[model samples]
Target: MVLKKLVRYIINKYLKDYIEQLDYEKLKLDLKNGHVCLENLHLKPEALTDLSLPVTVATGCLEKFTLIIPWKNLYSMPTKVQIDGFYMLIVPKNGK
Candidate 1:
């Protein structure tokens, strides 16, 4: 499956790099059925506030790409998330 291949590539490239920057004791990634699951993740409060809240991404898999960001990391900011093809973006809401 091409989607499976893409997922594997993503895991090997971006995901691995992202995980390496995180504290191992706070986060873990699990791969199953061509999906990547992030478990027991923790993010800094300041990081959350500065984060691009609305995230967007595309997946050809039968399952949706899920990102479980902790509430403490949300910071009640309006987020604009958009997904188009292979592109994803998380940006501050512009009151639209």
Candidate 2:
């Protein structure tokens, strides 16, 4: 239960703003393989708000995303991120 809470906290802290839709029920975590998989995520329009950009994301979708963490060599090895089928549409806030 503690581990699950930690994972949820991390996700919420790091990804909640950017991810508009995330089905926690479908989240997959393979501890032995050190792999975390997320699929069919929709990005929020405010994803770029911190960037202070003039454009907005009209639509965004991530088909799949994978994070590979090396637990054994967590300090020595760099984490890897794999993103597939990421689509985004950006338009000017003024509709230009």
Best by TM-score: 2
Error of 1 at 4 (Å): 1.6
Every model's Cα RMSD, please?
15.8, 1.9
lDDT of 2 by residue, 29-95 (tens): 8867888888999999989889999999999999998878898999999988889999999988874
TM-scores for every candidate against the unseen true structure: 0.24, 0.90
**Candidate 2: pairs in clash:** none
lDDT scores for all predictions? Answer: 0.35, 0.85
Between which residue pairs do clashes occur in model 1? 56-88
Q: For model 1, how does the per-residue alpha-carbon lDDT over 46-77 read when each residue is reduced to its tens digit? A: 23233456532221111123333333435664
Candidate 1 residues lying further than 4 Å off, grouped into runs, are: 20-36, 41-96
**What count of clashes does model 2 give?**
0
Q: In model 2, what is the error at residue 91, expressed in angstroms?
A: 0.7
Best by lDDT: 2
lDDT score at residue 84, model 2, on the 0-100 scale: 98
The per-residue C-alpha lDDT of model 1 at residue 26 equals 30
